[model samples]
Target: MNVPAAPHSVQPVRLRISYRSPESLLQAFTKSVGKGGVSLPSQRPLARGTRFLFELTAEAVAHPVEVLGEVVDVRRSASGEYFLNIKYVPGRSRKGLDAALLKLFEAHRHEKSRRYPRVPVHLKAQGTTQVWSVRDLSRGGAGVELETGELPKDARLGVPVLLELQLDTGRLMLHGAAVWLTGGTSRPKTPPALGVEFGRLGLETLRALDRVLVLDGFPAGPWQAELTFGMDAVGRMP
Candidate 1:
């Protein structure tokens, strides 16, 4: 038996959603959203009544807002795109989210959305032919993880390195400097990590980075974005 979906109103603001996948995270953008539901565009129509967890990204919000929902409706748009209507379910406390949203609707209505949204991506970082795992990325920099054997003890701060991102479109190479380091095999954390701040890149390289970021819900656009399961495409990551 099927239950009636809870009613909802359309919100003025739009948001991006990242759904959980067995491999990694898949992203989508909302056509319309509300306290009780949201409509998302999808290439593949999700199954009706299929429940899933997703993180919502909104303008000026520093962290991803968590939500749980089930697909209540699936319809094909006039333009041949698939629209999935999901009904929100209570999970985490929405007090903080509601407050932030209210502020966006009221006070900061004119605030511009972030031009460069950070994303959780796994890309390979190669410096001097040595490889590392770039776990998180933005247009400006990335957080890379280096294995115990790879972290050079003699390397000083601001050491220059090059990152080669194997994106679906093509290979993107950018130069950067090591701004910070943390973790190690014997250190407090599990794997060693480095914060690489990207230096100036060529016009083409910058465009490529922007393209990759857009695929990951950075500014939300139509792109060939999908989740990758193995780290081989993104370098060795634990």
Candidate 2:
């Protein structure tokens, strides 16, 4: 006879997420709705009926969208990843939330599809003792602006460098290699910029980067595809 699995214990959780823009918030909320409910990664499975308090905010919104939810399902993957499905409680703000979601959906319904290999961004990053401006970013690399005078004398293609980005959540340190440079003798007409391709990133670092990308309206499908490819490449490395 097969033994029954043990029941998960109840654990209350509270989470807060702030989006950079209203459009980003709409994307995330709609995606979650399509998945049946909000899904959050967890280290351990929570029992069904576990309560959750979520505070969602966006830069344009004056007030947070507070919602209470209960865990309706728990799932664990073969890779030991745990996730909880949270069903929202129909509170006083339910109608307003529904209306807002509908408005956002309608507004974007007619928008044309576009591809984003890199998204423009204004972010600060520190390398060694100098600060650089992050002008654009993609899953694989970043374009940073730095004056020719500021560029290190030893800076060249394939030179490894460490950059600490000031993300909204916190600072993220990344290892990268300079792939190209412009605005020097090679390309005098172009603005001074460095193309740095990131090295192998840890899971946490990838997740953090994902959060930033999502807020910047990066398409989820492409991001997921790239992430899977990266993971597969890492797995293949001896």
Candidate 3:
């Protein structure tokens, strides 16, 4: 959920999230939205960068009036429930998330509700000539399975790549740059995953990212999992 426009512009909020995924789904419960903070208990441990879709009540709504927020903290309790602390968008989303939300109400402008299910899809990355596969996809970016080979780490990250995504309903093609790479054959090892940011995104894709990042919950994955944090997408993580 992108932050709604608001008058009192603040800084971008860095929200931590506990998201339900195509795999692990979290049951809903109630807790405090703001004022002080919030927490959750877990029988099992939740990964850092775990994402969740939060439903906000009227009181939880800040100036933006949108209840959506991101989880910042995930702690394990002896009792077992995972504890979560979320910072709202005005503080995190666009950084200026607060100011933008108010703008909506002031303009009497109604933005269409943008929502796209995070359908776990595959992206095949073909370089300006090389070949890769999308481990998964979200709007802002994608997680891709890289070609196995020996290349300088810098070269791998700097490469411009194209992604061909096969959606449940259709196919979407896009381009992005690898900001970071993960997974080395060993530890202090390179993690078996890489972080990618979108080099180019269509309007629908951008909107899709907003909804998935803000509201959708990412459950655990079957493969080696790395909790995708922020907006970067990288998968098949070891």
Tens digit of per-residue lDDT, candidate 2, span 1-238: 1112335445346577787865565555534432334777776777788777566677646556556677888889888878777786544244434444444445555656522245445554444445466666656787787644446555667776555544445556566778887776666766667787888989988887766554322232112111111223234332
Which regions of candidate 2 are displaced past 4 Å? 1-116, 147-150, 216-238
lDDT of 3 at 80: 53
Each model's TM-score, in the order given?
A: 0.41, 0.40, 0.31
Error (Å) of candidate 3 at residue 29 is 22
Runs of candidate 1 with Cα error greater than 4 angstroms are 1-116, 124-131, 147-150, 185-188, 216-238
RMSD to the true structure for each prediction, in A, is: 13.1, 15.7, 15.5
Candidate 3 yields a Cα-based lDDT of 0.39
> In candidate 2, how many Å is residue 90 off?
25
Report how far off residue 78 is in candidate 2 (Å): 69
Locate the minimum summed-lDDT window of 10 residues in model 2: 220-229
Please give the range of 10 consecutive residues that has the lowest summed lDDT in model 1.
220-229
Q: Which prediction has more favorable lDDT, 1 or 3?
A: 1
Regarding lDDT, does 1 or 2 come out ahead?
2
Ranking by TM-score: 1, 2, 3
**How does each model score on lDDT?**
0.52, 0.57, 0.39
